[model samples]
Target: MAGEDEIEGRNREDEQMHYNSTNLSSDWPFNATNDLTNTSMAMVASSNPMNNASCSSASMIDSFCQTPPTIWDHHPTNSQTLGAFSDLNMQNNPTTSSSSLGFRKGNLLTPSWPPPNSAIKRGGMFLPPPTATPTMLPHTLSQFPADSGFIERAARLSSFSAGNFEDMINPFGNVPESSMSPYNNRPVQGQPQEGFVNGFKSTSGEGSKDLPLPVDCGTNDGSQPKNDARQGGSGFSGNNLPGESEYSEGGAGGGGGQDETSDEGLGSKKRRRSDQDSDYNQVKRSPQTPNESTKNNTEIQQKGDKNPISVANKSKHGKQISQSSDGQKEEYIHVRARRGQATNSHSLAERVRREKISERMKFLQDLVPGCSKVTGKAVMLDEIINYVQSLQRQVEFLSMKLATVNPRMDFNIEGLLAKDMGVSGTLGFGADMAMAYTQNPSQLAIMQGGIPGLGSSSSDAVRRTINSHLMAIGGVYKDPNSQVPNSWDDELHNIVQMGLNPSSTQNLGSTTPSHLKAEP
Candidate 1:
C-alpha cells in the first residue's frame, strides 16, 4: 500500500511538470480550452508508468485530461475565487484575448484572424443581419451613386451586348430617305446657270437722236463734200454742197423739205443737212461770234502772209505772253511744285551746275579715308570735317613734339623770308623755292627757318650770312655754275628740298673755312 501511494504521488508530480511545460496562454491564436486539453492529455500520456499496477488509473487520468475544462468546471469550493481571478485577468488583458478570439469594435462581422470580408453569410438566430447604412466610402470606390436603381440603370446602359450596342451606334436608323440632295435644285431666275448660253439683246437702233451718225457708216458724198483739187483741194471752197442754205431752211421749219431730200438722197444728206442747220443756228445766236470770227480771219490771214518778220514777231509775242502769265501765277500761287524744276535755259544751267557739284563731292568722298558710306551731303560734310580736324590735331601734336625735341630751332616767318631772299640772290633758287612753298607751305616755312642761333639776327644780316655760308660750303666763288659738295646737308636738301639742320652748321663752318682757303 505504501509503494502504490508513493508511485501515485510520483506520477502526479511528473504529470504536473509536463502540463506546466505545455500550458497555453490567452495569447495563443486558437481556443485556449482546446490547447489546454491537448497539453493535459499529452502530459498524462507521457507521465504515466507503463509497468505500474495503476494502468487503469492512467487511463482514467488520460480521459480526464482529454476532457476540456470550461469556465464553470472548476472545484466547487474554489469556483467563485477562480472566476474572480479570470475576470481580473480578462480586464487586465482584454486586447490579448479579444485579438486571439478575432473580435474588434468596428469589425464584428469580419475579424482580423480570418481572410477579411469573405462571401460567406454569417448571420444566424443569435446574430441579426448587418444593416448597410450609407457610409461614406472613398471617392476612388464610390465615384457613382450607391443607389441600386441608378447602378442598375447605368449597368444596363453600359452593357456591350449586340442589341444595345447596335441601337446606340445606329441612332438614326429610322430616319426617312429623301429623293433630292440637301442643296437647292431649282435654277435662280435672271442669273446665268451652268452650261447655259447667255445671249445679249441687240442695241443697234437704241442711240440718242442727237448722237451723230458714225463716220464709217455715213455716205461721203454729202456728209464729206467732194474737194476741189484745182483749188488746193479745200473742202470749204465747194458750191452746190450742203451748207448755209440747207441749215437755214432746216432751222426755219422746213421739215417736209428735209424729209423729201433725205428720201431722195442717202443717210449722208440727212446727217449733213442736220449738222449744217445746227451749226448755222448756233452761229447766228452766239453773241461773241462776230468778234471771234474777225479774230479767226485775222489769224488765218497772218498765217498765210509771206512776211517772215511778222510771223517771228507773233511767235515772240505769244512766247512772252505765256512766260509772263506763268511767272505771275508762280509768284502769287502758294502751291507745292512737283519733283523736277520747269524746263528753261536758266533751270538747265542750274541743273548742270548741281550735277557737276554732286560729281565732285562724290569724287572727294571716295578720295578721303574713313568717310561715311551714306550719300547724304550733310553726313559726308560732317565726316570730312571731323577727318580734317583730326588731321590738323595730329599735325599740331607732331609739330609740338618736334619743337620739344629741338627747342632752339626757329620756324619764324621773317627767318624763312630772309633765307628765301638770300638763296634767291646767291643761287637763283626763285623757281625751286616757290615750288617748295606751293607744295607744302607749312613744311617749307619750318624748314627755311630751322637753322640754330639764327632767330636773333635781323632779316638782312641773316640773308647775307646764309648766302656766304652756302657759297663757302659748296667751295664755289661768285660763279653761277660750280660743282656742289657731296655732303650730308646737300644730300638732305636734294632728297627733301628743305633746309639743313642747325646742328650741321658747326661741322660746315669748321670744314667750309678750310675749303674756302684751299679754293682761293
Candidate 2:
C-alpha cells in the first residue's frame, strides 16, 4: 500500500509541473479576458457618466496600453471634462474625439505649419486612407458639406488611400517597400492605365506610342468633310481637294483610280452647286445698291464668285475711290465760332483789326519799364506817353549843353565828316554819306540846287544838308550857337510828333519849316 501511494504522488507532481509549464508558455487567454473586461467596462462607463468618473483614473491608465482606443474611449468621462474642451473642438462628436483626448490635447492644440485640418491623427501622426482612387476622390470630397469637418477629413483620408497621386507633395520622402505595397499594387477606379498630363496621354507610358492623337472635342459639328479633315490632323489645307478621298490619293493603286475618277466628276458637280449657294449667301449678306444688284445677277449667271476675298477687296477699293472723288469735288474748311464771338465776315475783319492793335500794345508793354504790372490799356498808354516826353526833354537838355560848351563852333563840318569816315569806314551812315558824296558829285550838286519843290535857296539847302550830315556823324561835336540859329529843340519836337502820329506828315505840307532857316 505505501509503494502504490508513492507512485501516484510522483505522477501528481509531474502533472502539476506540466500545468505550470503551459501557463508560462502563453498569457493570451488572460490578456483577452482583460481586454474584454476593459472594453465592457468602457462601454458601461460611456453609457453612465457617474460610473465613468469613478473609473476615470483606471481608464486613463488603460488608454495608454490600448492598441487603438475605441470611439467610446475617445469620449470624455464627464460633461465637465467634455465642456472644458468644447471650445477647442470645431467639429461634430466623432471629430471631437481627437480634440477631447487628454494626452493628444497638446498635439491637437499646437498648430502645424500648413494646419492639420486635412489629415487625421493615428498613432500620434497624420495618416491618409489606404484605398482611395485619385480620379474620383476629389469628386467624393466635394459632395460633403463644407462645414462638416469630420466628413472632409474622412474624404481626404479616402483620397490619400489611392496609390496614384498626380501632383501630391510627400514631405516624408520615399515610402518603404513594405508599407507602400498595399497602395502601389492596388488598382484605382476610373483612372486611366496611361496617365494624363494636360488632357494628353503621358508619353512616359509604353502604350502611348500606339495611341492615336486626341481628336478636338469642339470641332465635331456633323459636317462630314470638315470632321474628316480635323480627324486627319489637317485644317483646311488638306492635299486632296474638298470632296476627294484622302486615302485614294495616297498609294491606293490603279484599282482605286477608277473610283477616284468617278468621285472627281461627282466632286466637281458638288463644288459647282456649293459655289452657286455661296454666291447667293454673299449677295444676301451684303447691302446692295441699284447698280450692284444688277451687276451681281449678271455675275452669278456667268460664273459664281470664285474668289470672295478678292471681290470684297475690289468693292472696298471702289468705295475708297468714290470717297476720294467726292472729297476733291467739294472741299470744306471748318471754323468754330466761340460762345460770344460774331461769325459774319464784317465782324471777323473788325475782330482781326482789334487783335492786331492789342498785339502791338502787348509788345510795347514788354518794351517799356514799369508797364508789365499795369492791367488797363489806358493806364499803360499814359505811362508810355510820359516816358516818351521825358526822353524828348533829356535830348533837348543834352543838345543845349553841347551848344553852350562849344559857342564859336570853329570845327569845319566837311573836315569832321572826312575824319569820322576815315576813323571808322565800317560806320553805316558815315560810310554811306562819304560814298555818296565821293561816288556821286551830281547828287551834291542837286542838293546845292535847293529843295526844288519847297523853293528853298541853295545856301539854305546847303546849310540843312550839312546839319543833317553832322547829326548822322554820331560822336561828332556840333554848335547851334554859330552859323545856324539855336532851333534844335523845335526840330526834335517836330520829329517826335511825326513819329507819334505818322498821319500828321500829310498835313505838314510841302513848305520848308521855320527850323530849316539858317541864321544869316
Candidate 3:
C-alpha cells in the first residue's frame, strides 16, 4: 500500500511537470526570440507600404539592405546580364568568351552547385548569397509549413552540432559531407580539428594573410561571387555559405528619406531582424543533431504506462455516495405468506410472548445491572420454554381427570396451553377422577381410587362441557317421583344403564327355594 502511494505521488509530480512544460512550450511562439525577423519585416515592408513609408519617412536605415551591389550579380537574372556582358565583350575581341570573360565552370566551376540542401530544404532553398541565412534567406521559402519549417531548421542546426548528417539530406540524397570528404571511403570525423577542413581561420605554418578565407561567405568582399569562385576549393568550399556574394545593392527606395521611416525604427526593425538573423544562423549552422524531440516524446509515453489515471477521469463520477440508513441493501430472497402468516400467529401469541419476555428481562436485570436495560418487548420475548412445558403437563393431568367421565369429550391439551408457551395441553384419567372427586365428597369417597371412562364431545367447547358434567356426576341425582334425595347409592353400577347405580338395581324377594329365598 505504501509503495503504491509513493509511486502515485511520483507519477502526479511528473504529470504536473509535463503539463507545465507543455503549456510553456505552447506559449513559446509568442515570445519566440529566434524567429526570422529580417525575413518577416522584409515581407511586411512589401505588403504594407505604410510600414515602408513609416520607416523611410522617419529615416529608418535599411539593415536588410546593408550588403553591396555585387551581391545582385549572384541572382539568376544578374547572371544572365553578366552572360550578355560577356557576349558583348566577345564582339570587341576575337579572343572569345573564355580568356577575356573568366574561367569556364567546366574548366573550373561545376555547372551544378556543391553541397545539397537538407531534406526539408525544398523550393527556393538555394537562394542568392545576399539572403544570408536560410530562415532569412528570402521571404519566399514555402515548401514546408511555418511551424514545421522552423522546427526542421532548428533540427538541422542541432544535427550539425550532434553530427547526424545522414538524416538531414537533400531530396537528391546529397549532404554537405558527401562533397566535402577528401576520400570516398572516409567517414565524417565530426571533430573540432576538422573545423579547419571547412576553412575556418586555420594557421598555415607562418605565412599567408589570414589563410585568404578559402571560402567566400557572400558578405566577405566587394567582388562578385563568380569572380570569388576562381580560387582553389572556392567553387564548393565547405566554409562558404551556399550563395556567397560580395555585396547586394539596395534598391532605389533603400534607406532614402523619401521613405517616412526613422532611425529609431531601424533599431527596432533591426532588433526584430537580428532575431531573424539568429534563427537563420541556427539553420545554416546546422549539422547532425540529437533526437531530443523523440526522446522527450518517448519519456511522455513511458510516463503514461506508469500512471493510468487522469484528474478528469478520476472526477468523472463526481456524485457523492452515502448510505441512507445503517442497514443492508439486498435483493428479496424470499416472499413470505403476507397477511396469512400474521393471522396464523394469533394476537394471543403476542400476549404470551410479552409475558415470557418480561420474565427473562427480570432475570437479566437481576443477573446484570444497568448494562442490561432490556426493552419491554425484548424482556417479554425472552421466556424459558421449559417453564411452559411444566405448566402444560399439569394442565394435561387435570384434563385427563375430566376425560375419564366422558369419552366424547375430545380434549386437546396442546391447544389449551396458554398461547404464549407455544405448546398444547395434555390429559389423564386419574386427573379427571380427581377433578370429579373434588366436585363431590361422597361420590369421591365411594370410588376414590377408581378411574372413570369418557363420553363423546365434538370440539373443545363440547369437551369442556362434558368434563364439567363428569364433575357433577359424582353428586346427587334428582328422583323423578319425589322431590326427596334418598340415601345415595354408594356402588356405581352392575349392568350399566345410564344414571342408575349398579349396586342398587338388583331385586331380591321370596319367590324361589329356601336357599335362594331370604333367610328369616
Tens digits of per-residue lDDT, candidate 1, 40-115, equal 3323323432112123322332343321111112111121222243332212111111111111111111122122
Per-candidate TM vs. native? Answer: 0.19, 0.20, 0.14
In model 1, the runs with Cα more than 4 Å from the true position are 1-341, 408-520
Model 3 TM-score (2 dp)? 0.14
Candidate 3 weakest lDDT stretch, 10 residues: 199-208
Candidates ranked by TM-score: 2, 1, 3
Model 3, position 235, has a per-residue lDDT of: 14
For candidate 3, what is the lDDT? 0.22
Error of 3 at 227 (Å): 33
Rate residue 163 of model 3 by lDDT.
19
For model 3, the stretches where C-alpha displacement exceeds 4 angstroms are: 1-44, 47-68, 76-158, 163-520
Instruction: Report the Cα lDDT for residue 471, model 3.
Output: 31
lDDT tens digits, residues 393-472, model 3?
A: 97898788767845542333312211101100011122233234346655433332221211122234333443344334
Q: Provide the clash count, candidate 2.
A: 2
lDDT of each: 0.27, 0.27, 0.22
